[model samples]
Target chain A: MAVSSQVLSYYSFEQVDITRFRIRPEINRQKVEAEFSRAVYPYITWTDGTELYAGDYAVLIIRSDNPKLCRSGLKVTIGAGLLGAEFEKALSGKKVGDSFSVLWKGETVFVTVESVKNRHKPELSDDMIAALNIPDVKTVAAYQTHLEKKELDEFFFEHSRDAVGYVLKQVQANSSILVTEADWNQTVEWSVNRLAALAAMDGMELRTMTPEDFRGRIPVKSYDELVVLMQREAWESVRMSLLGEYLAKQNGDTINADGYETFLTEAAAPWGRTAEEYRKAYPEAYYLQNEYCDYFRRAVTAYVRKNYFKEEKNEH
Target chain B: MSIKFAEASTFDNLVREDDFVIVDFFSTSCGPCKILSTFLEDLEAELPFLSIVKVNTMEAPELAERFEIHAVPTLFFYQGGELKERHLGVLDEDELRERIERYLY
Candidate 1:
């Protein structure tokens, strides 16, 4: 028996526009694994002492079992300063086999389409059909009617709650999204102004009330009661931070190099500071950077276990 | 058992009567307040010793403000016209009953 050649074509960085390039029809596991094994230069720099060039690169790997309905899926790694907005601009309109480049850092690095691998739509085995409780699992329509209506209803209800819960969770998780001194001062000032307006509505002078005085006059039932409410809100904020960090890590798949950069920018945006600023302000950001990666891994694991892809049935 | 409800204006009269009063401060818009009102109604059905009263904050803002109530629903246990214990937010049905039993009798 002869072994089949499973290796896909590998492209050097000089051949394509890595920023805008895309692979058509998607690639399967064999191609992806091979791509991962291949090494590509990530950074290129000028010999001049004043200039530095950094190329953030990632291997696009589409697992054979990848469930994305799109033509292709990808995994990307990139430098921290690039915003997702840049990649959206670069690759949104481009087709597969197209390539282009833009200035990155101080040097221009060429990017190209290395390979395009076609994939066959996967088939569900008899075991899968039994697991799905369906006689036919070949087409989307086949499985549509067999779904449990009540389960779907419960799912939607749960989904809505989970959506809100996720928001609350994100707020609670990302509590470490540090508010700078200036940002905190700004928020305090805004809150004070709003409070002053409320006081003025009651024919009270804003000048007479300080922040401490304002809190006192708010007529809380008790100190304990106020603390409890504030604590709940704080927890929600922390949850949001954790969720954002989780999202950035789990969905490291991007179509282009710019997309990877954009992800980093968004992941760090909530802190009301740059990723660099966060690292400078708190030594924890350094550890958090890696911790964020771990969070994404956990999120992806949970997401897979939850089987978020299956459409739920409608309930009465 | 008689279930008595006192309007904010009549609260003074009820307190002056030297009756052990359970005053519920509630708002119509609050979900917990609605639940609590039903709970109080059930308590009134079971307990004859204590007078259950409700004050709607929306209708009686002055009374709510007087008590410094920022949130609803709040419960106040009064004995001989003096506040003994106060509960803010939703209270468990059993907890409310226990508090009323300890304070009123």
Candidate 2:
């Protein structure tokens, strides 16, 4: 099931001047400094013979009589509880090549210290940003520009909810794009499934949990009211996404089957699957719906980025 | 107990002493940080056993450096003096509640 909408009459401008909706957000200097500090310590390689400490990235070799525990290259951040509580507590103060057995999940597992990695922070420099190996972001100056662009995009997305609402209202006024009952039902189904998944995470049965019990999340008094509220919210969101899709297409960007297939080929390559394989694995409609929605989002973002600051004047 | 402010000097102590601590690095000028502060206040009132330590990035640059906090509104969840998880943004009430409950029990 795909959400379909058409732009009957285009906006007068080549691109919708997004400047009126844009806000110049303030940047926090300390946050930038901290980010620079993070970039300096992108990763910590194993330092041979170094002792493990709290906050150190530790790699271990498990050598157990049981095949289950014979795993090697188990990485854990000391005091990070990523592996578990006991795994970290046992690794503290341990040096490379040291052998010890720790009780993990009620099983005594033998472990050998493989390597310990500690971040040695460097000064914020082009070399530091380059060390991060982030694509196309090699210099400190480019990173700053990237951060600014990111903030602007964030501001637009966050603040444009109202603007999008206004656009939907205008579309309703000028156009008669039918948001079918099936579309509404699709949204309702999505909400129900999502809420059910969240309930399952808490070990609570969605069918058994009372509305009062779930009121912390959805404030409606009854399940019926909840459905109505969800339907309304979903309708708006679907329209917003479709609108973005419509705008993106009107601006010469391809948000069609061909573009998505090309994107899928690249994405599926990582998983050793071709686009056709992916299509075969899932229902055709499921792929269409997912790809359509993704394209819809990209359309909106592309439209915004291309036109958002197009008319801004130079600052001396 | 409640939301307490921390600097570099007190940051380690707060994380070490408190059984469950959420270190929130924020700035006064940020819009998201402002929104998160209110959520934190409400969260603190609801969950009284945990400590929410607010470290103003402007005041505690050294603390941000030590923790390697990359952004404002960054939350580092610590349990038993060990890092449990770290999140970088304004978490919804339900998500924030879920995280707190996971550690509380």
Candidate 3:
């Protein structure tokens, strides 16, 4: 449910009178140490009297005075702008064992700060470095540098994906895409294979069952209607292919004949086919249409990453 | 509850002997097959006329191949020793009862 702006503006609300608060929030160093010691990845370090600041991961126990809202444990990153403003206000100054009550949707919501995680980079000892065993990363300092590089690579990849997706959406919105007969057949085959795999997992067989056979067995009656649905589903993938070709042409990322042959061989490997057999199975026009589309997307995305993306400082 | 067991050699004989028979093709390591086996055993009591034949695909590789059995727990229905219906996968108790009723009459 969307909370109104008026409710968000008012941080203070009617306080709840609890007959019995099940667990009182209390800051215990021993408990904190134990929790920290158990944590591995994104290692937690215990600190005294640390108020949960913005970007801090805090574990909270939330209970509603109204039985309808119920009680649940919530793991939240404080100041990530995810939690409601009022919820953040109630939690900002609170540390481990502190409790506060907030009004939400005309119901009194009681919140207890279970634990505030104050994280610090673990000591990069030889043991820690050895555990990772990443190539060319021997020292703790080297591992940190390697992580920074990997993070940069990830940032570029994410940005390129978003940019291509945005560009594709706009391009697709403007044009009419025609789903070929071969494309429709491929989609139906994929759908049938997926269904067969799921059935096999349940110790059931779907031996040699085509999409038509599957549709007949299910609630869906009309084969034509199923075809239409499959066509509608295939549009996005078809558009991706079209956009890939368009992007490749626009950016001059063209594949040579030799490169195409090599790609065909690699692509056919999963299907346990030689490139010659694969080419014969799929007509030249059909093969090139899909193959070039994939090649373009990969090429254009790489180009966008290399030329257009910059990494920013990320919150842990 | 009694479930008639079949090997590659006895498979034809088992189906031919019964007026209605269901051959359950399954593997030992298959978890869903185990559940379906228990369900079939319970079902045998409810439908005494329905002769259920259990065939281990591992033991009867030739039978599995002859039937083109790609996945485990495949059920092939036979009436008067002729293949009538084929179903692959775990059926819930209701579905199993309904399928059995469809062939029984």
TM-score of each: 0.31, 0.45, 0.29
Model 2, residue pairs in steric clash: none
lDDT of 2 by residue, A1-316 (tens): 6754444554422233445654445555655654555465433333444887765666678866677666676555665454567777888889988999987656788989887776343457888777777789999998887666666666667766654544335544554445667766876677666566555545566667787677776777666776788788777655555555565666676544545565545433323334565443333333445554555555545555454443445521
Order of candidate numbers by DockQ, starting with the best: 2, 3, 1
Clashing pairs for predicted structure model 3, backbone only: A25-A97, A26-A97, A204-B89
Model 2 alpha-carbon drift over 4 Å, by segment:
A1-20, A42-122, A155-160, A168-173, A237-294, A301-316, B1-105
lDDT of 1: 0.44
lDDT of 1 by residue, A1-316 (tens): 6432111222211221222211111124443332222211111111211111122222222222223311122312122222243542443333335555633333333333323222121343434334444455534334333333334444444444443334333433433343334433433444445445445544566666545654657644443444454444433333333444545544573222333333343333322223453333223432343344345435433443244333334311
B8-76 in candidate 2: lDDT tens per residue?
Answer: 788888887766788888877567888787677655433334588898876776777677665667988
Deviation of model 2 at A227, angstroms:
1.3
Query: Which candidate leads in TM-score?
Result: 2
User: Where is model 1 chain B poorest over a 10-residue stretch in terms of lDDT?
Assistant: B41-50
Could you say which candidate leads in lDDT? 2
Q: For model 3, how many clashes?
A: 3
TM-score of 1: 0.31
DockQ of each: 0.01, 0.02, 0.02
Candidate 2 local lDDT, residue A74: 59
All candidates in order of lDDT, best leading: 2, 3, 1
